[model samples]
Target: MKFGARNQITATVGTVKTGDVMSQIDLQVDHPHGMSSVMTTESLQELGIKPGDKVRVIVKAIHVLVAKE
Candidate 1:
């Protein structure tokens, strides 16, 4: 999941923020944007992620093309 950034950066997962129940979990990414976005609890859970660990981030842009639809 490594993306277009240095592989030496690291971050820690802090407290979980939930709003109005069933909300997306807010994960604290230490290094911020120049590398990757902080992942949410739900996102992490979906990807089987955990705290106190290093994870790779793969970034990509999705585009949709239309032809007189």
Candidate 2:
């Protein structure tokens, strides 16, 4: 699928936790870090996401905030 988001990362499914209405998907990304996405259970089902599956993580945002101590 094509998306407008510029930040897309290829990752492998690590874990999937599905609730009654929502699901939390954890991706095992490249080296040292990973990401998580929360979506509706229906959406998750539509994507057919499962453990060990390869998927793209798309991130689109207008503003990103950074904090320094």
lDDT, each prediction: 0.45, 0.90
CA RMSD (A), model 1: 8.4
Off by over 4 Å in 1: 5-8, 20-41, 48-51, 56-69
Per-residue lDDT of model 1, residues 1-69, tens digit only: 546533333454444444343433334465463332445546656765544445444333332234694
For candidate 2, write residues 1-69 as lDDT tens digits: 798876788999999999899999999999798889999999999999999999888887554456899
- Residue 61, model 2, lDDT: 59
lDDT of 1: 0.45
Error of model 1, residue 61, in angstroms: 14
Report lDDT (Cα) of residue 55, candidate 2.
Answer: 89
Q: Residue 40 of model 2: what lDDT?
A: 100
TM-score of 1: 0.30
Model 2 TM-score, 2 decimals:
0.85
